[model samples]
Target chain A: MTTDFRSNVAQALKQDAVQTHFRTVVDRLRAHRQAALAGDAAFEQLRNRCAAIRADAIRRLPQLLEQFESKAQRNGIQVHWAETTLQANRIVLDIMQRHRATFLVKGKSMVSEEMGVNAFLQSHGIDCLETDLGEFIVQLAGEKPAHIIVPAIHKNRREIAHLMHGHFSELPYSEDIETLAQSARHFMRDKFHAASVGLTGVNFMVAETGTLCLVENEGNGRMCSTVPPVHIAVTGIEKVIARLDDLPPLLNLLTRSATGQPITAYVNMINSPRRPDDKDGPDEVHLILLDNGRSRIAGDPELLKTLHCIRCGACINHCPVYRQIGGHAYGTVIPGPIGAILEPQKQGLDAATGELPQASTLCGACAEVCPVRIPIPAIINRLRWESVRKNQQSQNSRPVVPGAGSRRRPLEAAIWKIWAWCCSHPGIYNRLTKLATRLRNRLPAGMGAWTVARKAPKPARSTLHESLRTMDIDHE
Target chain B: MNDARKAILDRLRLSQYPDSTPVKCDDQNDPVDPVLWPDERIDCFINRMRAVRTEVHDASHDSWLDILHGVCQARSLNNLLVSPHTRRGAMIYAAARRFPALKNYSQSIEDWKSELFTAVDAAVTSAYGGIAETGTVILWPDAREPRTLSLVPPIHIVLLEKNRIYNNLAEAMRIQNWAMIGMPSNVILLSGPSKSADIEQTMTYGVHGPKELIVILM
Candidate 1:
């Protein structure tokens, strides 16, 4: 994926419509969030609470998982555990195979994207359909989500109208949003009723009460969870919190920051499969707690904050880099500032992902607007350092020692060493500078892509030491 | 019990460390506006809900049926899906003597979901009440008034009591103690009709759920 990063970014930037779409929508979202926060004095207080909840949950994650599992079991939900994507996919397939599910309806779940659930199910001869309107569009288009919240934000309505027209040839083609959405809704109603199994992603799992909460605008979430007899909710372990009471502020911050709404249209809390006396809802509910490298991250103090992310995509919207290139350029399930640092470890830390850690501009906009206040810039820098360390280790045949090779890092170290030596001794520095000044014209025009938009600096005629020596000793 | 669960939990438990003091978990509910009277809170809720494109109407228990009939008439909707077990649905159902022109369908979604999802024009379900801060109606769905009534139908009419409106979700849930007792399998917080701004960020309502949300504040 990193091999094509440069090309993907260049191609996305070339699309004038994607640029205008992101510019208008991001500007609107930024203003909407600002206006919403300006009216509320408790914004900071609520953010602090949300951060505290995330921190405390991470600290006591094991206990919370145990509590959640016991309570969920008591509530009649079967809990499954998976250590990796393959295991998670296998579990999902086993359930589907047991039920002989021919078709399934799914709510938007990034974890499913991480596990490639749709592709895996299709390989096993089961058709898994995405029910979220944005997800539905992207699925039909055979593309990944362009953005976290708005999956098809990169594609204009005309493209979607064309896509829909292609899918249902009998339906009249109209670029009108009403027609597109109406067609989708009418088409989805049949899938919702016919699918015997339902799959969904969870927003928050409350350990105290044993409930999985889902927030969305369209009622697809409700339909997928309620319409099927067998419902499966797969989520990362980091999503669990201590109690249900911790949700209000997080909910406030999440909705306001994500789409700049007071609340999303629907927040569904499912405590269990339908009780025996219940007239609606699934007969059996399966909750899959997926580890998939998250538990390893939980141990590291610096990387643990990645788990704090609520998947709100606030940082992505505010990111200038993301606005320019869009999410597809990131080439991962998640994108934007979060993806820059996260994709490496989530996908696999190889030469392919080494460039991803360098994707960010180290701007602090992501941290400022982050609902959970995850320090994204610091994480990116750490990932960059880790990538450098990995590169160094791969080059050497000798066994690596911790913190032993910083002074021997080759090119970067040699440059820094020369720099430190020059700063200390003025004699050689002045002589070297004079030589550099004489040979300034022979210097290269610019280095790589940096020269594209701006001119390179030319060497100065004299060093600071020479200038100071030539000046009067006492101007006063 | 899976070995993966034990293995992951073991690793996590060993690696767990909290540098900053942990945030204590407590029930400190936010009061959006405590000084306001109950009636004022209801007014606040209506304004916020209306801001989000939800239609609100003030009504008494006895007058709600007429208001509902007018809503049905306005949309030219003849068939309504209602649950006989729910209070609001039963109250409106009991008012069949006065409004025989409106048809009310009372059947479990689990049994007749396919027919209801297609044939029903609107669904009127009872609310567990509303949150004034966010302008959301809370529905603790049981056997009657299942989630489908609010989710599938094009029109979702909610019956929220004026006195039942609370400050926010925290206050409402704490007061109700839903996690401890009287916990329903599902709790739904519907702020407005189903909407999507996914296509070029243009807001469009009623994509999958009800397109119109009408609230009768009794």
Candidate 2:
């Protein structure tokens, strides 16, 4: 996916300023947090417990994932393994075709976006609908999520009212949120029961009990998984945790981090579909565990910590950079601090995405706010080195610069040649520097691009070596 | 066991690095803690519960019935569907009579679970069962009371009476232990209405579950 980073950042700055839209969401999340505190002290206790459970599960991720697959298989859930996004998309399309589904009702799944599932499904003539309210708004707008937790944060009431008025002919243009929401509510209620297949993103895949944990503020996730005859959950392999005991701590961190609440409005743990003599749930459940560069990341000691992320977006919310640019500018599915590291690795360190790593100010706010403690800044820097290395290798492998002995570009060779001359002749360098310092004030416009955002300090009158020699006169 | 699982587990066990050690709870006959006397513990529990996103009510007032009636009238749920648990509460029956078509069920959770999907217009279950952080419900998965009652219904109205709300999930889990001889087959955590954001990444409520979720906090 191509990310217009500059435009996304500009848009984020614009929409976030509007008090009615983004502020209302921020207020509601705060209200949810306050309610959690008011009603139950145990919310925090369970949150802590869920966190510990997740931490332990991550510690034994590979084993737990294997266990989950086996158990899920026993429960009649067909498990498919995809090493990359291409594979994941293909698998989902095949499943949709097998089911002969025309309209696919989907739940909020970052993994699906990561794999470009919608486009692939659409290309195959399978129409998919995003059921989450925030996701629905962004989908209609034809844009990537601005915020992970609240994807439509950039949209205000007027924009939503306009969208609803345009989409629903029966509804009048109303600025009221409740009235607008009711319109959307009526729009999707039937789509849920009508769709043949349902798609969801797994929050946590428990290995011990072979259960899938899905936490959502709305009941749409439950409907997507249950109402449809066939349910498909696309989750990264890293989602698997070892035991049920490890759920509480992760849930705690996820809730507080995502919404500042003790827990989400609902946490649905499904072991299997409606069994024999059962009245509810999907008839068949299929879980697709996606690798898509995750295993490669998991093998690396430095990058593995990212897998511990629960997609809470706390880091994004707290990040000054993310708040300024929002998620779309990151140009990757997982945005903010996590995106800076994961995107380049998941895609490549090629030119299209090379500017992303450079986008960050190396601010540790993302790391600080991260519940599982992913070192986003460090990983970003490492990716920069990898990108540089790839650039050097390509340059080295190129044919000798046509007429010269050098195999590098003229610009590269010229820069290095100048550096060699300066190092080999320090006295000449000192004289040239002095001359430049004298002419610095007289330099023409566009002399430097680096100094536009900042100013360069004036050079010293004399070289350090010369000053040292002059000071030696006192010693004599 | 598949070769993958065995291989992964073997590598983990052989590793020298320390991993999480599981702790076993010692409640065989009575897993739940009976004594609720510690004021500090209660206070801590209440404070933490408030820290999450639930509203707490002071139960000191004798007019709990008035509170119920007022909340019902406000949410426009005078026509209610209630579980047997609410019948035991003081003046709950009087409040039920106010709604002309109020449907009351004395059936077990299993029967109610099935009936809720097709028959019940708006279903209400007890919230006195669970704890704070997760907002989970402790439903014993037996022949009479199935796990689907809380999830399948379109509009599920959970009744969390004053005394039933525990300080945290630990106390709730402790209660779950005592309710049955051992751990029940299922435990559910409900935080909000059923929703989805699958189509073009737009969130539409009432996707698979109830469209409108109203909590009558009395």
Candidate 3:
């Protein structure tokens, strides 16, 4: 299917409510992050340390995965590997079937969202519930998460009140945020108690200790992982860190960057299933390590930076494009600068995802706020080249990215070729420019998408070279 | 599944550089500098906790039970969950008549799941330690005190020793030798009561977990 990026953006831009919501939410988030980081003198050093830690982890990803698997298995935690989302979904289904568990309660897991786990389970006659408040709101509304961290950020309090009232007829309609939250809590309490299995996403996987770390503000994560008999944790393969010591700095950076909190309410570390002597905890802990195009991403040294993202959503909050159009406009799982670079690589360049890279102003705000310091703008430029480059074949060498050069147009290529040729020869360039300058008024005002919201550029009355020569300035 | 593992490992291994040096990660430098004085740490911890809307009460070992009784009476809690096997639980049990009806989490969650989810009014558990920098309480939930005692109840009262407050998470982990000792089934660093800003970024407390977290620092 072709991407409706332009139309989606058009639709999002026209929604005044969404625009106001994005502005208010992102501004508050930006201020929160700034305030959280303001007093710390070591903030820059902490970010550098975090970036290095992630870089080191990605560099040693294969070995770390092996170590984590062995250590986790020794700890009596079952480890599953999935090369694709389909494989991952099947593994989850198989586990649920093995336990005869029809009810699943989940914490906020972007990877599970990547797998479309809820839809997959529901289709198979299983009851899947989102327990995180934001996710629950989005799920109740039959919508995808609008933002990575704040899933229901697109909905205002009034909209949420209506949605909650419509869904839970017993609850009174009130726009009070706390009342709405409490209603959700009351509704989910039974679900949590009844859920046979729980699933969550890993914030970081410590290979040294075989520990799965999850950070969240809601107690739903703890409840889901602890309350259920079976706990399944899913994460991308790249989230593995070499040692446990790497966690504190990364956690510090993540909380500060994500929501401007010194720390979240809960930073849960799961080392194993409940011990035989333990009072309460999951009997079985299963961790799914999903590749899902991340291995290919690691093959390219420059593009490998994409995997270092901690999914803090700080970059998204800081992105100018995302600020105006909001997340839905991007039409990807994770949106803004990070998604622009990631979705294309994961979905291949020829697919609808290829259009995502163009949804940026390359303002460098994302890179600036990025805790791990992924050079998002540089990566965006590289992907743009990868999408439209004419060099599809080069003897024995194959492109690292799938569908590379699929977006190249012969007309655009020919135009660039002519422009290059003219620039090399000054005589033809000077004559052509002079002729164009004389006939500047006859030039069309329209220039495709650029002219849609902007005036088309007109040639100067005289070429720069001619003007310089007339003023007795050096032509060079 | 095994084939998938092998294939993914192979692809990742192929991407590795032949001469990549092991990355040196320096963890010695503390991100948040450790406060030197015990008094400073305690003060900082209290400030941080109170900032997050957590109720912190300074109490002596002898007077903590009285404070607990007052807290229960103030909230009009009908029932409080406690782990009777623990020392503090035993103490509370000894003076059980001063507080509300006391319940022990001796049975498996499967046995008392309904009461724990709906009936429990408050819970009192012992914290492994407190992190001063983030105002976090560390709980290594195990046999004595299950994970849900601190989670399921609407009001969670944690008793933290004054000496156990560390400057930050890294220091706490190191001093406690968490990596060497091996992690419990779950280790929670709780900074505040459960909260969410998901609804239009408006801060809402008690979305899924305990709405009120009261730390009895002794």
Candidate 4:
């Protein structure tokens, strides 16, 4: 409920156990990614190809989505479109209502988290269960997913064991990782079978072939989509790829970048509902394409690159700010460099989530390791500008991000205006600097928040012109 | 709902870049170099599979059944879910007395959900092909071998034909003409047994799917 970014960061920094967990897991993930890509000579070219593929998909998103809809329908897969999160949730609810399904089982899907499907369904008198081991652990603890890929990365084994024991009282208390996993597996198997509707997120939607590709190490995704009679897939509109062949390189980059695996345990490609002649599979397949501010993001050429993200969480792994404060501190669905750029755009600049862009130190590690090579730092810089711009309208006739000038303040604007004037006028600038230098020691040691974690700046003893004159250097 | 679709499409259409050209990505130019695997394709496949803790057994076309029997005995399996209609499935059925009790996945999931989830100890299915570059097995689940055979059971035993092995996924898809023939309802590229690193980043097997993946590579 707390929307303030600074307080959330401070609160997160105070939790010693959480901070330690973040540092340990992120370091391991970074090392894993490094070792995975160490000997691959063609990694850079592969990144370029993947970037081009995603960029092309975003550029032709409308056409590809239309084509995908037609082809998916041809394959007997029902397609639904939602302009907002509520609409997306309603689509899922409608499907569940049609089947009279009171319980829904879910695979690991960040999109479902974005749609707040669980909370919505439960409020409407339905049971929604998260079946992924990590997600199940987080759900048992009554918490949100901290990390996208590893939902329980913020919790160590002992904490997880405690939570599991509390929920599954029949299972004996044990801190062993494998034992805990088995306990959850035994518990969720019944849920997976009894649930009538299952929902999952699409990793990549191939437009030409009408196929949904999902990559996961655990088979819960397969179970959720295959075991249930009704399967619903939710995804942001940006996940489409132009061709089926584009999947191999993207899949290679995604697994390697996210975890140090040459390939995950399973790469499931679901094309349609079970044919009438088929033995066992989902009887109904529903695809819900949620356009929650994505089209607005696609309106801007530079910001359209945000949609190219594969959600590998590599940027989150490499982010220094995220390593310190962890994911919850950001108070957003996604955290780290990608989230810093993406959430601000998705939620607009005036919203509390607008402060996410400033959370980064502009470290380039994220872009350096991005599988699709999204220039995250550069996008953060653009968002920073967009947040504080004086005019809400952009100069290039492109639509400005919502709440464009909400961060601008009269005092800050006046200070920058004075600084600009001082730099433009030589005589006045020289006089002001000389005057300031003579009284340098009189300046206050504290300069507001700037001096909280840093020393205040003082004018030099002499101007550069004066020093140059004494040293006999040439002057313009 | 149509209004929502129209609104989204209209907003996206406005954002289309003028003079957009079709992106060209040459599949032949893919960077997963074949030189990375200098050894024979089967060797690379076996090595990669073993790296991820997958059990790979070498067998001739005639000896694969013996290997399957040995695997079942070693694990002391009670029952194996299979599609007795496949060629290998037919072979297993013809020599049924030598192996454990077999269960067929011929019934609809709604009718067989309870037994399939509780009673099946392992599953045996025919892999359409294998990828040597990443050591993945391709399963085009159909009317005979349903998608859940490799998924719902604790143990998954695959019968792979040696001749069907390809260098990588792209090669497998291209040579198989997947785009031209169209994709099946479910196509899985399974590399290893089901596992997860979600608990403090610790790797644990059999979280929700097969705990053991035995490949009889012939």
Candidate 5:
């Protein structure tokens, strides 16, 4: 519930395992991304195409959604619309209840996490199983997803092995990565077979053809979509694109940026539910278009560019702040620089996400590597400004404003205020400098956190202004 | 549902850029239909696919069945699930007769889906074509070659026609003209075997789907 990032960062850093895991995972991803894009001639051109398509799609979203809905309906796929997470969950549950679905196999859908779909469905007496290995590991461990692409990136192999060993006799405490994968595969494969319905996230919906694309390196996405009698895809309204031609560049950018793969192992373009003549594929396919705070962002000119994000996660991989603490510290469904800005947009600077804007070093790496060219740092700064401005009215005559960086250390603000005042009034400034030189030995103490990492340079006995004046007097 | 749809669309419309003017992307930037020299495409396709641990075999239509037999024999595997409705599946059924050691499963896609999950060792399906740029094998699966044939079993063997290669995904889709007509119910592009690096960033093959993907280029 808390996005008190400073404390979370401190705690995360204290865990040697956490630090090591982040370092290893981010480093590998960084290298992989670099290699994947290295010498790819079409990268920049394709990036431009992707950006253009997103802009176009957002501009014409209503039309595209309408077209997609009609086309999908024609394809015999049922489409549902949800205005909020609660409504979206209800829609999914109603579908499940109608189907008499007991257990569900799920692909990795960040939107599902946003809606708390699993918890909601489970609470309503339907079991939803996460088929993605990372998701499964994290789900069994009773933790929320930590990263967007690799949810269990925070967990080391030994930790994963332990979690699996506790649950399955097949594992019997094997730490080998391959052995662990086999055990999980054996364990989840049956669930896929038994589950009557599959739920997945849509990477992009090609409006022209009414195709829903799900990209994945593991076959779980394919399994979840194909094996089940019923399939439901949950996606935000922002995921739609204008045409099938827009897919190549977007897919290229996504795969390269997310996992540094030339392509995911499988990319399923679901055009419809199983055709009457088709043998395998979902007999009933449903798509839930959820608009939980995204339409407002889309309408906003300043913040609308954020929707251009393909969720490639390159920004997260390249973010210095994200690399330091990993994703879970942010306490949002999506984490890192993207999450920091996006969460505050959905939930205005409240206690839960109030500090997210301040959690950055403002390093522009996230922007540099952002395939969609989102100015993330700019957005975070805007959120910070809004937070501070909002706090101003609340903190009437206070030394510092609440919900602002200056408020955390009011003494620092007071000192700076005094300095500004003295500088404004030359007579007082001269007097203070002379006094400071006179009593240089007896200055204030306890800078606290600042003095911990940084050495305080003792202010020279004579101020720079005083020294300059003394030299001028001597020359005269 | 309709009420929700209208409400969501209205909210989106309200928030949209005031001008209805769409962002104009350069038409010049649009990638054209690709045409590559056959040798160049084949080489590019093989290297890209193999880079991701895919086993790519270059074969003629005459030698493809022999190559398939060799692969199955090398693995000492049996119980292959083939979509008998497909031309490639029929070819496999005919070819598999020579080897009494091999057992073929051809139940209807749903009837044997459970066996495809548990008992089936390998499954072969006919691919629609190949994408040379990313080394992807495209499958427009139907009742004949159902989607599960390529997904469920531990090993997936796809029979891809060589001349059907497209330089990139966009070109392939444009040529397919799915939007103009109608798209297949499921158009899948498989690049390699199922892989996961979720545990310790260690890449492991065959997490939930096929462990091995062998693409036979004919």
Candidate 6:
């Protein structure tokens, strides 16, 4: 029943424990609802400013990128560009080869996962270690992140105890969170001090200054960037903000939305490395700005706002569908409401992970809680249309499986067809509605799929059409 | 070696002036406060250090010492380590005289590894200055002050002068680089406490960094 960290979509769908954990998270969301709603007005204002900043950056992206490259190069930092995941991985590996790095210490970075940096390094006999505790757990379990922020939210303490026991047989089983944390701390301390190269993700890149912002809750991020001889940061180009002054509002909104904290625990801005008079810091710093289909989203009016996402995972925590299926079902580096829409755009709607768009119920909860106010359900619906288009394109000349082919998902098709029919014939619809109202109590159980989890509301005794007719308001 | 040096500078996009002579110091007053800059100007330069979650208060007053003592007691233990900044060391010592329970261990970064790192509960150093827009404290590295002293300790207390605070990060850098005549290799701007949200996204404090930070303004 437990949600195995390494499980794929098919395996996650069958896990009952994951289902129950999601239900619990959804049930507890009411506790945060009041506070979140109160913060909405302030969040909206911040989102508007953030959008302006990003829009401006996008317009000047190329020039800013060139400036950053120039400045970084002048500061002795090697700047690299990768148009695809393969190229990014190769570039990082190339650096490792140049440094003859045996040990790779990683700070928390979703972009690296998107590029499959760990697998690439490990395959080449490089020892890559995750310094972030949540990432370390999933790394140990050989799994992709389930939640963007809290990667192991679906897990209980006992499950972690079991995982730790299996990994460290000498250690005793303990349900205490602190004890488990200490165990991870002890395991990673030596790895960090010994690493030759460190990989990190950039929260924001300053266009004017060419400074890479490293925001985290722990000091490991600092250590990763400073202790290692070579430090590499992987980031999507959309993370760039135009000016340094714009950082505060983004920082404020990101922290409050992500963990309900007023400010981040650590916001380290490194312009360059140790000076001649300086004591300790990385000898070399490299930044790789990735443009892997982000430009396509920037041009689309409907998808443009998706780029405003700070990846705080606030919407994920509040999503009804996400709380049920968890992050694994989305099958992308980022999961939940945001990922469902973004995955298809970045990887194509016909990509093997097409089922992601269908995961949501159009509950409107994610949109309500999203700090940036991305109409997630609307985007998911668009992705569904895109999926349908792709399916139809591939459907040409394929042999139909007799009557079963036409009848596949018949109940769903029939419901849509009926709704379309009702809209077309108002007179017939009115008559049908009145008849249904009279027979509401006598209806059969399980009248629709909705009945599986919720009871159908009792129909009104009479339709508004009937009242209008009685009042002589309209005859047309 | 000469060829390597030229290659390095060429790669860095810097101009090598072999014929240029080093500017000789004209004033015999003090090289530490070079260029005949006033104490007020130096004070203004020191104002760059600002608090993150906490506010910076000048240590020139008596009540400020009480606040420091209160913070020391609240943290449950205290044996302080400070730089050779006479003003900073004096403030702590005066506070200790009032609150005998508190103890002091003052040493510069040169003596960091052997003297300060092992002995102190809190390592207090003067911030080179602060960037107001970023809420970052700038600490310059010196023989008497290694970067490890600021990082390795669990609690970091920084002494910053009010006049040294800059309006934005750009100004802070412009002033700093101008003061040094060239940008130093290390410039660190810290926003808040040292923390990590890595464990199941549950944030815990003091993860491989200082657990606590206190800034003293003068």
For candidate 3, the iRMS in Å is 1.2
Tens digits of lDDT, candidate 5, A399-425 = 121243422346755787789988899
Best by lDDT: 3
Off by over 4 Å in 2: A1-59, A390-448, A460-476, B1-119, B126-128, B133-155, B159-166, B170-187, B192-218
User: Individual DockQ of the candidates?
Assistant: 0.69, 0.20, 0.81, 0.83, 0.73, 0.16
Worst 10 residues of 1 chain A by lDDT: A398-407
lDDT by residue (tens digit), candidate 3, A1-476: 22588889889989997899888999999999999988778888888889889999999899999999999999999999999999999999999999999889999999999999998998999978999999998988999988998998899988889999999898999999989889889888988888889999999999999999999998999989999999999999999998887898899999999999999999999999989888789999999999999999999989999999999999999998999889888888999899999999999888887888888998999999999999999999999999988774569677888889999999989999999999999999989999999999998899887797899899999999988989999748
Can you tell me the CAPRI class of model 4? high
lDDT of 4 by residue, A193-310 (tens): 8888999999999999999999888898999999889999999999999898889989999998998888999999999998988877799999999999999999988888899999
For candidate 5, list the clashing residue pairs, or say none: A299-B15
Q: What is the interface RMSD of each candidate, in Å?
A: 1.8, 7.0, 1.2, 1.2, 1.6, 12.3
| Candidate 5 chain B weakest ten by summed lDDT | B98-107
lDDT of 5 by residue, B1-218 (tens): 88899898887776665665768775686655356899899889999999878999999989998998888888877667775556776777676665323334434556776666777788788788899989999988776667887788788888888888889887787787756866678888989889998887888998988899999998
Relative to the unseen true structure, what is the C-alpha lDDT of residue A290 in candidate 2, on a scale of 0 to 100?
Answer: 79
Candidate 4 residue A253 Cα shift, in angstroms, is 0.3
Report chain A TM-scores, every model.
Answer: 0.92, 0.81, 0.97, 0.97, 0.87, 0.82
lDDT of 2 by residue, A1-476 (tens): 22476655666566645534444454455455455446554544444444445555656666677778887888778888776678778878887888888988888899988888888888888888988887887788888776677778767768878877887778988876656666676677668647779999999887876788888866677668866778899998778876554565567667776766666657767777656645445677888877765655555555566666788876666566765565666777777777766766666555345457767888787776566667788877766555544233454453111111222246766787897899689788878776766776666644364675566656566655567778884342
TM-score of each: 0.93, 0.74, 0.97, 0.97, 0.90, 0.73
Q: Estimate the lDDT of model 6.
A: 0.65
The 0-to-1 C-alpha lDDT of every candidate, in the order given, reads 0.83, 0.62, 0.91, 0.90, 0.83, 0.65
All predictions: root-mean-square deviation over Cα?
3.5, 7.7, 1.8, 1.9, 4.3, 11.4
Best model per DockQ: 4
Docking quality tier of model 3:
high
Ten residues in a row with the worst lDDT in model 5 chain A? A398-407
